[model samples]
Target: MSIVWYYDFISPFAWLQWPKIKALAAEHPITLRPILLAGILDLCGQKGPAEIPAKREFTYRYTLWRARQAGVTLNFPPSHPFNPLAALRLCIAAGSSGAATEAIFDWIWGHGRAGDSIEALAPVAAALGIDDPVAAIADPAVKAQLRENFDAAVAEGVFGVPTLSIDGRLFWGDDAHEFALACLRDPSLWNEPEMQRVAALPIGAARQA
Candidate 1:
């Protein structure tokens, strides 16, 4: 099974760990899957980062330290937590076309003021080495597929941004990311009894023949 890198470009924390994540993906047999985030939040009745009152302060402070630690250059700019629902759909729109979606993912989380404006995405897109993902975003089939991804993420028990799932076990949080990296580096570490039992399950009766 592959690891799913579930993220929304609008999340700063998601942007922060991106460098390491991409590097980790390179070193392991991981398929970086980008899922649209806003749909997940809406389905859950969760507000944007800038909207939540109780946890917002602590979250930003934590994110600042995290960005510094990861060496990601971030400019939050003057913007409310801009919605990336459309962008998320756009990402789904660009599926399997190559690095366009991945590049778009990086730009959304990595650069200046993610979620503020579509224009902000241009520079990040350039950095990812793809300037035109607009074509994918504009397609009707792709748009619907993206919406479906958000629905899928919610159905899968995802509650946070930058969530990762490996072999169907969920890892949610930057702290969990390292664990994901470790499991990917050494599949032998996955000898837990539960997983072994599941893996060993017979698909069909041997006596059927």
Candidate 2:
């Protein structure tokens, strides 16, 4: 079965689940799609968890706990919510090059380096043998490609990062990884009927005209 993994570099959950996702890719055909989380959020008219003070605090604490449980070292960058446009564009430039893509994620999420600009990503590019990282980001084609990726992701009903789509079935969030894996292993699960369907809320309340 083929799976499409829609991911954003700035998502802590996406970074946390990368190892498991990569291992799953080893067992199945997986497509790594780099997308802009900001675009997706804007398109969906939703707010990120980090935008809320309470949720943001909980997210950081929970992320650290999860990282410890998983034996992964995760350090928050000097700042949160840094623009990841350059990193996203670089992934598009990499284009099926796994090493380059992995390095980008490692540099930001693993190393706690803020991925705000191309210059910040220079060391990562050099390590991955990408000689002209700055030029690559400046390439009009690269910029356009990333824009296209964002559009495509919005079309696919992706409202957040770390979404896995298999056979048109959408499984979102890092916590849903096991369920996605189960669906991949058992196609019959995909055919199961929906548990329940809730009617949409009334758009207009009873109007006394």
lDDT of 1 by residue, 97-195 (tens): 336555665455444545444455656444544456565456788666665656656767887778877776677777677777677678665677887
- What is candidate 2's CA lDDT for residue 188? 75
lDDT of 2 at 172: 91
The 10 consecutive residues of candidate 2 with the worst lDDT sum are: 193-202
Q: Largest lDDT belongs to which candidate? A: 2
Overall lDDT per candidate, in order of appearance: 0.64, 0.82
Over 1-209, each residue of candidate 2 has an lDDT whose tens digit, in order, gives 55788888888888888898889878888888888888888877777888888999999999889889988878887788788888888888777356766888888878899788888888887776679998888889988988877776777788898898886678898889889888888877766655222233346666563
Models, CA RMSD each? 8.6, 3.3
